[model samples]
Target: MATLARLQARSASVARQYYYRNSVVDVFRKKENDAAVKIQSWFRGCRVRAYIRYLHRAATVIQKRWRGYLGRQHYQLIVKLAYYTMKMNLYNAMAVRIQRRWRGYKIRKYCFNYYYLKAYLKAVSETNEAVREALEEFADMKEREERKADLEKEEKKRDYQARKTHYLLSTKQIPGVYNSPFRKEPDPRELRLQKAKPLTHPRPKVTPKRSASLRNWLECTRARSFPRSAVLPPIDRKPCQGPFRDIAEVLAQRYKPLEPTLRVAEPIDGPKEARAELQRQEWTRNVQDKLFLPFSSYHKSKKHIPAMHLSSKYGPDSYGSQHFREKNPERWICDKDFQTVLPSFDLFSEYGKLYSKAGQIV
Candidate 1:
């Protein structure tokens, strides 16, 4: 029974505590606190909320102070403007009043002076006419004298211009001498320097000599430092240009035709051999075709002549293994007159070809 009683007491105490915690006033207070906490949480934390509130207060204070300052400045500006406007109005009024008084004075003075001048002019009319006539006569005389002086000066200027410098130099002096306005007379006792000599000889009467001009007398001058190379050698570029056309034809008869090589040629003695030789000759007829041989004068695929032929080659010979050069310098300049001239090479090759062990055609 005592344990049951104790349990009942604990239950009643729990019920009372629950009722107290869940009361209407407490619920309202808790709701208000939750709302405040929610706002604080939205600001990141309690510290952040306090900082934001403080900054808001500070900014409001600063804005209020700034508005007040602006109001004070505006008031001051308005007061200054009003004062300046008043001052300007007062100055304008004073100037207007002074101008009125000055106008009245000027009108009075003008009226009085007009009368005085009219009476004075009426009194001196005859005297003024006489003075004017005298002045006109004096002006006319002065004008006539001035015109005569100007004419005399013009005549003197023209005479000076017409005078020759040669005559001045020969006479050694100027007549009716006037003091020079710019040129001061030389002091009689001052030390004097001699006149300077002429800058160069008088302008040449004859033209100067030029080397390249056909009409000029000048020619290629001999350079003593390089005497050997300075010799005037006849530069005959083309042998067939001037006088060697007929001579070449006549000299060509003197030289013997060069021997042929056995790079592509074949001989036959029998009927079957002749038929094979004819077929071989027909196949080699195409000059564009490149065949491997002992030597070729040109490249296989290009129109350009290859340097291999220009070099000294011991190419094959028909009669014997005779060595020969593709380009002989003695025959290059004038070979038509030579006795041992080589046969002319064809556009592609008559006998010249590339040497290959396989003897394949490309």
Candidate 2:
């Protein structure tokens, strides 16, 4: 019985240990499964975070690209609008100018016709008045001549009667001498009488009808408008007198030309050299007279004219005169001569295009 009881206790102990080991393994398995689930959850969270970050980055890039595209499109639209506006303005200005020119033409025609008729009538009236005055002076001279002739006749009649009475009374007393009193021998002091004729002054000649008429017309007419102050004086400008005459005489003497001499320089070796030398000499000579002479030769052999070399010295400014520049500053004179000598340049090309556009607008 003791042996049987000991074997039973040993079997019970083995079974209890096996049960305890099985329970411990189940608990460990449950713990491992919980840890795996936590790890999977962490991986899913990380994947979601990575996806969100990628989406944010992609959205930012798309927004920037869209903004840039819109900006560029807006700029292009603005430029197109400005260009159309400028073109419209230019067309309107040209239309206005054409209308103004037409109106000016009509007004000028009316003014010229009205003044011409008025001037002609005034000239005719002045001529008539001058003729009337000349006729009156001639009539007065004829009347004076008739009165003087009547007075001379009366004096001669009185002298003849007195001489006849004295001759009749003294004839018998002086028979041998035969001194007749009618012949004025009775009184020596009153023997002969002399009469003087009246003197008449000459009348001035009347002026020609055409000359007087034109003069009156010009004086009555209004002066025409001109753009510049350097205008010619009236056609009736008279010779200066007194102090003004002296001043004019002095100026004439001062401005008189002095003796001039022309001397040729040595002949150049080539046609180009000769032309260059001639231009330089001509420029020097003209400087003394305060004149500027631009040299341009069409000769095939002559290539060194100052015009050909203009780009080297004065750049594009040498294209035209200062007056042309003042009127159209944006326009440049572009020629073969200018382009050939001009240095290769990007800045000038851009500027030249802008200038050409502005020139076309003007």
Candidate that would win on lDDT? 2
Q: What TM-score does structure 1 among the candidates reach?
A: 0.22
Candidate 1: RMSD to truth: 33.3
lDDT of each: 0.58, 0.58
Candidate 1 structure quality by residue, lDDT tens digits, 1-362: 99999988899888988898788568599789999999878867768879999999999999999999999999999999999999999999999999999999988877567778888988799789999999999999999999999999986664444342212221135422232335476422111111212123368688875333222212225332222332342345333332322323322332326545433243223434776888899878867665444436555455553486665446664344432334356666674322343444574453333323543221
RMSD of each: 33.3, 45.5
Q: What are the models' TM-scores?
A: 0.22, 0.25
Badly placed stretches (over 4 Å) of model 2 are 1-22, 26-34, 110-362
Among all windows of 10 consecutive residues in model 2, the one with the lowest summed lDDT is 335-344
Q: Tell how far residue 188 is off in model 2, in angstroms.
A: 99
Best-matching candidate per TM-score: 2
